[model samples]
Target: MTGAEAVGSGNLVMGRCVIAGKSACVLYDSKATHSFVSESYVQRLGLPVCELQCDLVVSTPASGLELEVILGMDWLSANRILIVCCEKSLLFPNSEEPELLSSHDVMKELQNGAQCFLIFTHLVVEGEGMICVIPVVQEFEDVK
Candidate 1:
């Protein structure tokens, strides 16, 4: 069902995707630049893996996982399947309409000006270049 029909449910996009002749539930997350597959899922494919040195790094969980296939930026770029989605249904962007930026993209204009590092963040600037910087850290040693 589309988002219009499924409102109360979270903003997760669920769809059936055919990969290697297998249909699987594909969750679209714009924030996630990379894709991943569980070991159990790939194991079902029964494809022999080639032994190659890969610098691809994934954050280690508390417990080590024996198997996981991650589709990184390289994979996404190579497979040019554009996912156009909004609050409603997902589709491909037409010639007339342009695709909006993904959640991972920088949407707003950020101020690059250097603000003096003070005790805390969000310091209010006073009139005419006046700032009172305070030390957040204190230097004191406790003897046991």
Candidate 2:
């Protein structure tokens, strides 16, 4: 998308969400099994921190990180919702690989803090493979 277009409609799944009475830009990841809040933001807002049963080491371009307050399975179950995913209404929100993660249950495991990081995943461009993880939070307006 062009810079102007991105500034205009924004991208898929980007929307306004209220976290701890503050306006937070939230992105809905259909693949993400957990919802995460920024640790620093949490600290700033003084949100309650709860101990997890285990640590959550996440894979990212920066190697790895262990989080503290991951709003995972419980959060998703609590917020059973389907807000906005993509801009186009013609496109279906559900994935074509419905059975892929049906019984999979957990798609990601994070101990607690999921402030934000980049993970390198494979993408095909004209039959050629590319390694990239676009940091949309930095690109979008007021995503903190």
Candidate 3:
């Protein structure tokens, strides 16, 4: 699904998975055509990325998604996995013995400081007007 759809649905299946021996937040998005990894997460983990032959464009209507990796249909199809949304589990039909990966609600995990906050502002421009925008970050302590 598009980032906008995922945000609107609010029923995203999220879980913790180990990548390269490091734990990371993983999103199982069935509607997404291809998988993606957050640039910040990759850089932080020093993971190697190979150049793709073709360019891919991603549109996140509302930015600041805190997910570390998104497992899209590409990965799911390759593994012949079935997503049991109601049970919040993944069924691996291709495995010699069917295996299931169950996931718990991620709200508790996110509460432990893995949250991302987005700030939005409105800008007005007149006819044929040009505007320059800069981003500033401020840190605050004891913000409830």
lDDT over C-alpha atoms for residue 59 of model 1: 48
**Model 3 residue 115 distance off true place after TM-score fit, in angstroms:** 37
Q: What is the lDDT of residue 50 in candidate 2?
A: 91
For every model shown, what is its TM-score relative to the native structure? 0.37, 0.38, 0.53
Compared with the true structure, model 2 gives a TM-score of 0.38
Sort by lDDT, top down from the best: 3, 1, 2
Provide backbone clash counts, one per model: 0, 9, 2
Task: Write the number of the candidate with greater lDDT, choosing between 1 and 2.
Answer: 1
Give the root-mean-square deviation of each candidate in angstroms: 14.4, 18.9, 21.7
Model 3's TM-score against the true structure: 0.53
**Tens digit of per-residue lDDT, candidate 2, span 1-144:** 443444355443444556667766444444456767767668867879998999997531111222223344445455554444344212223444333222223224223432223443764557556756666554656656
lDDT of each: 0.50, 0.47, 0.73
Model 1 bad stretches (over 4 Å): 1-9, 49-76, 87-144
Model 3 misplaced stretches (Cα beyond 4 Å): 1-8, 50-54, 61-64, 97-144
Weakest 10 consecutive residues of candidate 2 by summed lDDT:
60-69
Tens digits of lDDT, candidate 1, 64-124: 3232344444444555445445653344433565344433342331233422222334768
Greater TM-score among 1 and 3 belongs to 3
